[model samples]
Target: MGVTLFHHVGGILVVFSLFQIFFTPHCDAGNILVYPLDGSHWINMKILLEELHTRGHNITIIRASSSWYIPEKSPLYTSITVEMGKDVKDFFDEFIQEQLKVQREGLSLIAFFKLTKKFMSFLHVGHTLWCDTAARIFENPKLLKSLMDSQYNLVLTDPGIGPGVVIAKYLKLPLVLNVRWITSGEGHFVLAPSPLSYIPVIPGPGLTDKMNFIQRIRNIFSYSIILFQQNFVLAPIYNAMCDKYIEGGCDIVSLLQDADIWLFRSDFVFEFPRPTMPNVVYIGGFQCKPAQPLPANLEEFVKSAGEHGVIIMTLGTLVNALPEEIVEEIAHVFAEMPQKVIWKHRGKRPSTLGNNTLIVDWMPQKDLLGHPQIKVFVAHGGTNGVQEAICYGVPVLGIPLFFDQYDNLLRLQERGAAKIIQLHEVSGHTFQRGIKDVLHNDSYRHNMQRLSHLHKDQPVPPMDQATFWVEYVMRHKGAPHLRTEAYRMPWYSYYCLDVLFFLMTVVTMLLFSVFAIFRCLFCKKTKTKCKQN
Candidate 1:
């Protein structure tokens, strides 16, 4: 009996030891490699990473050698540079080759070849690369091999496509897709604009803007042909090269499909009609940290405006090339306004300036938004700027340029938080009216404040949600269960409702035929009985 009891005690000890070994926290800290393309992208990424570091997550940023713009000093995060093989010269060379091929062949193959060549032109053979810099880390057999051998649990990526998604998919690692802007998915519930919303107008917006019924019909066909060329021909050509070089066997949409979860930097207040994907989460207005104090000069500038306050104008990063006529019109609008204007003019300043108008090459956007005296934001409706305005509960007068700016402005307009003025149609009258409407209207402010409350009253802040999801991926050893099985189904199977309807029609027809046959047989029997009588 003593020997048996001793054996039982030994067995329990063995079981406990095995459990400890299997469930022990091997990854106390996770290694997060970020790949943000440029300045704006880096700043957005920095906000999220800073929050994660604060919460005890290990973070690393890998960027291109030329991308030297640092928005913030992050001592906790380490930065590495991946060298590029070729520079701008190689890009031009590839462009020329592709153009020449297209001229010669007039076919889709040339377009695809040129895209691949252009991608290669930018990178140094084996040392440097394009697409997302994160791919380099994965392709670095040494780094990836070590991580695979070790116990790092998760890899968080951004823009949801390109190198970042490819690395996560190839490693069979769990990933969170940080969709900062609009992706190919037309119906994502993020603050980002849909690409379909920006389809260019033919004969431009000038003539087509006021087209009659016949003209509208003709324009639709023309637009369809252009769209067909762009989507079927041009886009596919570009995507094929992206698949070959950047993604290593996968395409952009396929990468998005493979992600464990999607984190959107937007709120439902804007009302983007998105499909109900179980893994997608809307966490907009994430950059709601307290603002840093404004500079003394900037503070003075606002105070000098007195009761009227200021109207801040900026045409975001990409569309800095404002036509001289538009600049003149903007100058005229400011001249007539009751409020002082602070314009972020990236190019040459206009010769005529009103006493109330202040033109600066660049302004501290967030700091300016936080100011109590600043009443209106005259913006290009970029997702970042739009969210910042909402976070601060400030009204916006949007000048939509390209891409998702139109949709972004429309969403804001629908919510009564802002108004939109198309870039092509901007004039002194329209500009002034838009400014007055947004600044004077009490409703815009009320709506903005309501949204601000909703944005702030989350179970966790946006950054915290980002951190929780990141760590959750690490803890679960790649959240395989969250991945959608949509890819496994064929295109035909996915549109299965159509297939079901087709089958139902066939079954109904067969049943009707059988009923008719039985009725005919009964009638023949009745006729034969009548003949016998």
Candidate 2:
């Protein structure tokens, strides 16, 4: 009786300790100003905001007047609406449609160039609108005064858009970028050492880190496209904005590289091994959580699958549905499969609809991924979805449409955790075969499970790491120590090309001097021989 009582007391103590460790919030309650990029980026930003709110931080969001996802009133953050930005959401919808049209033309050099032009053209329009919006905010005196008076501890923002970065600079606040992408390219290219020999640029012609000579050359060529997009397409607009509003003026790339911390949305688990910076906190799957109990009807539907389990397919938020013909192929494929299919489809109901398939307008993606019954995830290869798939140990069948989707899936495919079927390759035969290959292949499940284990094995949970770093910036003002001074150097100085030139000059002079001495000696000896003769 005494031993049993002692064990019970110990159990209670352990339970209390666990509760304290997980549930307790840090004491600092900071005033944070957030300028978020809307659409899918807004989804992850909201997750980070919720965590900050839970920890007693007061959040203020700078949203455009035309933002669709971010509401004016929310318990999590007080919204500051900036007027005159376009209702920018529909632009992406159009861009993706055009990209799909181009992709369907299939693989050729001309087609590739055509698609790239379309992408660059799309970026030009997006950046032009953002520039106009930033100009409006800069022109507003009252808005500037209000932001200054609020006295934020730091500016936490999505650097996918430039206004937040400019705003942070204007306020002289310590900046923390919740970034996977900056205005120019992937965050790492600016933040860390990226050797093109190894680290393949995402969305470039190269897909994996291991590149041959030809692939490396292709990588360099593709990298130039990003540089062109940044310097020519985006720079003039941002530079003009900076000159007008900012005191002395600053360039967009400099302002971004000057950020105190980068909460990068990738880790080695999801990405190939590459060089990184101290301040880059990788909270790759931070938004993922343990699965909640399914709603009763959904639970019943899932249970009805018995031993076959289930397959969940979503092409992410941007795409409403695939092209009608492709959708019919996928729908017919699902009909033939033995497993239950819960597809997030809102397009015209396919005539090939199966009793085994459940079509919904939306889904709790994270929860469904986490569920033990989930067999394989058919995805559009978006960053959020890919990371979630990694977190949940679900193998993926990727149907890449456009943007970074193919390259994103390539990372998983290289690891043997996923398979990719191009937009043009989708057919009843291909879709069915790909699903079966991923579903039946034990290696796919085992490899994905390995990644899941590795991702979860971090000492601090990704979300906690993200929240800690945000508060750390507030406490320390800014982490200048972690930031490298390499960004301050000019390109020649940065790569030590100037130093190389100086060394080469010195070596050449020494060699010439030595040759002159030898020549003089030889001439004197010849003179002596002539005199002797």
Candidate 3:
């Protein structure tokens, strides 16, 4: 009876301790806010925020006034402006000035080294500092001060913009890094587009032939340099500044060491060397939300395409500036096709027009895909567009231009949900054949539908996962336990080659000693026998 009583007491204490550790001080769920630097990001943020709001969590969104590439006239502009507060612009201006000061100083080596070491330690942490040109403009000390004072549970930031990550660290807030593309070592999983979608590969006669070997080499080297700057240099420096300036004394990785959860939008189908973090959650197909209602005229226009159906064409926001010659080739291909084409041209239309082809400067993409008459989508394979197509259960013909587009299309191809055509090889025949194959092929549609169902059938949508994790951090007073011990291990030690060599040497010595002893014993025995004889 005494022993049993003691055991019961111990059990109660253990339970109480666990509660004190995880639920102490009672986390304020209302103090959660999301920062998506630009308007395009609002789409995904909106889905997650709406779900969270419905669940009775207070959420605030900081919206950027404009993006570098996307103009104010774009549909994305209006979407952001609708719910945007004034905080984003104010924050961005301050962020830019601070960044420029650091850059002018050429980044302090001491700070850089210190931050890099910290990053190396917790390399497995899902937190990443994104450094893109546009993001630099959005960092604001005053906004950070407000958030810090508010005691917000956590800050979720997009990768490619260093300022957000830096500010989160500065404010000593827990952060979740959102990787939108296949960027450096930051992404737990990278979303890449198809190789055929690249500008160099997009089908065109004599495209590669025009460039000499030296020019091609120069281009490849130039791309590598740009990647290096973004990944190795800028990312680390930005992180250091956040640590030194924002957190007062703590570095970026130390700030990140408090965070372990990452919400990735990439599937294995897109990125190679799939990154693993202690708490990374893959949520690639999350963008596959239900299609929005179509405009009356747009719905009618798609319905007019009939049994053969229509093909949708879009080059995405970044690379819509295609040369006239390539546009002409695309135009010619559409003219030859028996299937009607709905082309989303960002710029002026080509002179070559066909009765079957309807060229518009822009079209409501999700609505068009939802239309019954739409059969296939030809796209630049941007992450957002790909997810939308998958959600709508539409097959794609990926024409990747650059960056993660190759990786994104590769994912689609691996899933048998899309076909990839090289941009340089884009000819009338190739375009026609590729379109026909996707339109006529039963397998493409079947694979897309199957994946779409799997994507949609998740117990909670990606937005839910995103929201839950965010809330979980709040509820737990920050999920610090998820942070990895990678920071403790040096780069060389993480690889374990040093330990491996040490073990190998010890084993080799032991074997050699044994062999020598055996040889010595045998020799002694032989000498004894000879002497005895």
Candidate 4:
């Protein structure tokens, strides 16, 4: 009886031990390597990395020396910086200059298209240079061998960098894309569903899910243009980089198709309704938080304004400085406003600077936007800034310059949360009136607050959702089951274009055959009639 009792206790102990061994943490102290292309990408990635680090995952970041922010070396996170031999920040500055030049000249209908084509070409060149510079890191034999042996659980890539896909493939690691932009330029079709019928290919032309006949035609044309550029232009640039850096050619399309997960910096609140696959996750306001206390000077400034409130103006990191005349015109407008203004000016202070307005090279944008006295936010309409405004329930007066800024602002306008003044259209009266309208109107505030509530009222915080999914992908070893079957289907078959063509071809053949037979019978009958005659 004693032996039987002891045996039963031993069996229970063994079962408990096995359970503990098999069911530990989902992540299992896994190593995660992240490649954030630039400051913009890094800003979106920063909060996600913090969450992952706190969760006991080993985090490694490969940063460019020109990266705006570099986290300190610690046990939780480490970084490897690649010297690009040029200030990458200059790229943004140059791009902005070109945009300002065009805005100044007022783009002609033909010149606008030509300018767009030129800018896209220039962007490709920059991407090539970026990828080539990044490839230098892999040239180090020891580092490459160490990374290969480490067997990282996941490779978090910013698809903005063309070479990131190739590097992940070379390491033989599972790929998870961190796309920071709303625009789907970077081979995203592989993992996400881009039904062009309803989805606006670009930002404007008054498009929504319920598009009119003309709008649908415009959507198709926009998608066709984008597809042509991606396939004919972007694909070759990426493929060339792959051949130079990777052993087995990592095609961009193939890499995206094999990606385990995609964390988009977007949300349903901002985007029109569109189809999404299992592997795609939206964490739009993941990095955003409620306003923090302002600095003493800024606090006092807002306090002094009293009932008048304050306005915040910024063009984000990319365009820290604006054209001189535009700044002067803005300064003049701010001088006349009843509210106190805080302008983030990187260039020389405008001579029209007012006592009511303060000029700074940088400002705590999110915190300022969250302030109660803050009435309006005049910005360039970057996704992060727009989302931050939405998070804080701040009404925007957008002065969109380029890229998706125009589209982002257009969407905000559609939602009645913002007003837009194009770069070329920014005059003293226009800028001032735009600000006055948003501040005076109750509708903008109401819509923004509603969207803010919707954005915040989520089943789980976006940060946790992102972290859980990242770990989930790692735990499951690539999460192949989560990927959509669409990736496996060819482009022709995916859209059913091939099937439609085949059916059409068969019907045409049958009709022709019938016509031929009818003609033959008619000829025979005519001959018979002639013979009878």
Best by lDDT: 2
Query: How accurate locally, in lDDT, is each candidate?
Result: 0.65, 0.89, 0.61, 0.80
Model 3 regions more than 4 Å off: 1-29, 37-42, 53-144, 180-186, 189-232, 239-243, 246-258, 267-278, 511-533
Clashes of each: 4, 0, 44, 0
* Poorly placed runs, candidate 1 (over 4 Å): 1-27, 68-76, 84-151, 180-251, 273-275, 497-502, 505-509, 512-516, 519-533
Question: What number of backbone clashes does candidate 2 have, counting pairs of residues 3 or more apart or in separate chains?
Answer: 0
If scored against the real structure, what TM-score would every candidate get?
Answer: 0.73, 0.95, 0.68, 0.87
Candidate 4's residue-wise lDDT over 346-404, tens digit each?
A: 88889998899998887988899888999899889988999999999999999888777
Candidate 3 minimal-lDDT segment of 10 residues: 197-206
Over the full model, what C-alpha lDDT does candidate 4 score relative to the true structure?
0.80
State the lDDT of candidate 3 residue by residue for 329-437, as single tens digits. Answer: 7888888777788888876678776888887777888778877777899998877888888877899998766445655676678779899986666667887788889
Question: Model 1, range 66-134, lDDT digits (tens) per residue?
Answer: 654642335867666666444433443445444434433443755645554443333322112344344
Please report how far candidate 2 places residue 176 from its true position, in Å.
Answer: 0.5
Regions of model 2 farther than 4 Å from truth:
1-27, 531-533
What RMSD, rounded to one decimal, does every model reach? 11.7, 2.3, 13.4, 6.7
Model 4 TM: 0.87
Ranking by lDDT: 2, 4, 1, 3
Q: How close is candidate 1 to the true structure, as a TM-score?
A: 0.73
